[model samples]
Target: MVEDRRLAVLRAIVEDYVRTEEPVGSRAVVERHGLNVSPATVRNDMAALEEEGLIAQPHTSAGRVPTDKGYRMFVDRLTTLKPMSGAERRAISTFLDGAVDLDDVVQRSVRLLSQLTRQVAVVQYPTLTRSTVRHVELVTLTPTRLLVVLILSTGRVEQRVVELSRSELPDADALAGGGGPEVSAGDEPARVVDAVVADLRPRLLGAVVGKRIAEAGAALADLPAAVPDASRTLVRRVAEVLGEAMSDHHADERIAVGGAANLARYGDSFDSAVRPLLEALEEHVVLLKLLGEATAGGAVTVRIGTEGPYHQLASTSVVATGYGPAEAPATLGIVGPTRMDYPGTMVAVRSVARYVSRILDDA
Candidate 1:
């Protein structure tokens, strides 16, 4: 009973401190919380909590504030997540679902999270490797040039123009019943390129879009051979470009940030907490490392003061989670001072991640 009572006292102190940004005295805790105890009992509990290094007196005669360890205890005590209100969830969905593309989804997520949490928000885009092939379009830009457009399930499109020549493509004169690289009937090259594209589109669509590519190497070995002799070079070059595009992506390092100006709210601790974190946000490497700590499950992680990889910003705290359909999907979260609202911030971070995940996965 004593331990439970002390925990209750600690919880009240943490909540009051976060809300007021001032040291919490025993009388204030008794007045604000329905702990059903006298000020004397609360003071004794506070003393016990301070003995355990959970709360501390900032001045010789001031009220107590929670320590880093205290914040960890407060966060851990949340046995179950606090669900956001229906209106908040609806607001998130309505705002995020309006995104026009994958990039817009990321940008909106960062903005919404920052607005909701009133803290710096960072969102990492899901990598291309996690996306499946949606569609591929081959456009005949010219007799010797083809436009390769690859679409992914994430609503992302990659386009590359591949230059072909008689060396790689069939000679125009050959298609015209002549044997040379010389231009024949104006429409011969166009007809030949279009035919090859028409044939290759179905073949590539049948393949996944990854390193194995528009046609995994093993599946594509016979592709060139399967096509007509005149289209072999065109098929080979188109497949090669797609293979390169599928493997050419890096989102782990790509981050969209917002609400950095919110750090100024730290007031007295602005120099100690806000300044360092603001500078650190510029170095995406640091933000990536912090967000990397967030796990794939919906579990919201809170890394408070010194618990994170960078100890230099000990006054900063991170509340983050991973988003996307993959096992190692990208991450998104908020960064703020330890004195911020933990419960509210955790809910905001988690809600934003879920909606963003839904948008990316269902796109």
Candidate 2:
């Protein structure tokens, strides 16, 4: 267990350093944190902390600064995040309530998070792989041509078309009457088409169908024994939709970044640190993988300095969390310098994540 006094001292140092962006001295920590401790006693604790590598001095006479380890420990134990204010909750509701669609929700989420945190924001769109099939429709355009459409639980739609030779055309009338009809070399009569439609209805119900035109063609060769060309179109449509949905979800595994301009204010370390981060933002996959870790971990994660893979992010830090329908969590959070205001940023990130999750859940 952490000593209460030590934790208090660490919290004071972190809060003070975050606000002032300067090294913290024991005197300053006591004065600002209102701790009932003498500077000399605090100094002894500071020395111990420095020895433990939780705090460091840039120079012999400089005040101590919290090391990355210090920040990590403080984050792990020293802070209790306050819930978002009513006004903040109202603002989030007001902003996200206006979103018309999934894309709108993502766009507004990034903007709201960035505005609230004053840091770069990253939001990953909801994944669709686990969504259930919603509906499938088959439309016949010609004796040999058909259109198939598939819709999924996630609001994604896909369509495909299938074509077959007229000779292979089953009796559409026979199918329409829910009866199968044998095919011959001659053109199918209207009654046979009706019977064929009637016969195929039972076979198509609730089955996860594929849209292989070749399969349909083979089925067509058997006449009354063959499936409808529309069935082939339906199968093709399902495959096409599933494939497209997966690809779209993969392509959209992105981070909606904001507040990059803030990095320029760092001056000296700006190019070395911010430039590479900006470049990495262009590679959506890498950012997705990074944020994916945070989401999967189900907590507020901090990646500091060189701990992150990209060398350009060495001077930066990322604080991320996953938020969505409790049943289907999605990721959203902020990226900023190691010097960022952790308490306030955490509040903003968690608050926005909750709101985004609510919006997606309702949608």
Candidate 3:
């Protein structure tokens, strides 16, 4: 366990270093933290911490900066997360209340988190693989054209179009020369489409809808003797959400952010370190993979320096929490730097995660 005075000094050092991006000396620590300790005594404790690999001097004459170990200890033993202000909570509620759809909520969340934390923000769309199919519709357009629509429990929608040739119709006798039946003058095409949909459900229900026509042929064969040469438009708007959920088994739902602009005003090393992280942000899969491992043990996770996947992000850090519906596995938390304002960042991350989980639960 960390002693209270040493922990207080450590917390003071972390907070000061994060704000100034400068090495902290014992005299400065004593003066700023008001620890009631002499500079000599503070120096002795600093030496002890350095010996423990918790802090390090950049050069022979330079003051100290918190090492990854130091930051870890600070996070584990010293930092007290500050709660969001009532005004801040009200603002978050108001902003989220305006969201009309899943996409709207996600976009709003990313922007709100970025603004509040002044850090890069990332948010994964809700996982859909475990979500049940809420509704499915098959619409017939012509003798050869059809449309398939799928809705999920998550309020996501996917659509596909298929074309059928007269030769493929098993019920060729029901049509005029297998050309298919022409609607009467007063008949609504939508009603006929609905009838066709009702007939197709038992055969196609819960089947994996693929991009190729041949993949769907087997299911089509089970249909009420449909025609051949069936072509499909294969519209898949929510394909990304489903594809990620299905294909990225080891991938956690997460967002990668490029908040380098926020750190750009710091020093050259910070700028250099932040650039690669920003560039790496484009690869969403890599970020999600890292978060997957972090949340695997069901704990708030923190990875610093080379401990994380992206070696180019060696100088940066990530602090994330897991959150989701009770039945679903947890999603990831906000990620930022080791030098980040831990108290404030933790509050923002936890707050956003709770709101996101609530939205998913309600959806």
Highest lDDT, which number? 1
lDDT of each: 0.80, 0.64, 0.61
User: How does candidate 2 score on lDDT?
Assistant: 0.64
Cα-based lDDT at residue 81, candidate 2: 85
CA RMSD per model (angstroms)? 3.8, 6.3, 6.3
User: Which residue segments of model 1 deviate by more than 4 Å?
Assistant: 140-146, 153-155, 161-189, 209-226
What is the TM-score ranking, best to worst?
1, 3, 2
Model 1 clash pairs are none
Candidate 1 local lDDT, 184-250, one digit each (tens): 4555657766766766787776765443233354455566766656667788888778767666763
TM-scores for every predicted model = 0.86, 0.71, 0.72
Query: Candidates 1 and 2: which is better by TM-score?
Result: 1
Question: Which regions in candidate 3 have their CA more than 4 angstroms from the true location?
Answer: 78-80, 137-149, 159-191, 194-260, 294-298, 326-330
Cα deviation of 129, candidate 1, in Å: 4.0
What tens digits encode model 2's per-residue C-alpha lDDT throughout 115-166?
8887778887655544444455656565555565555443345566655555
- TM-score, predicted candidate 1 vs. hidden true structure: 0.86
Sorted on lDDT, best first, the list reads 1, 2, 3
Candidate 2 global TM-score: 0.71
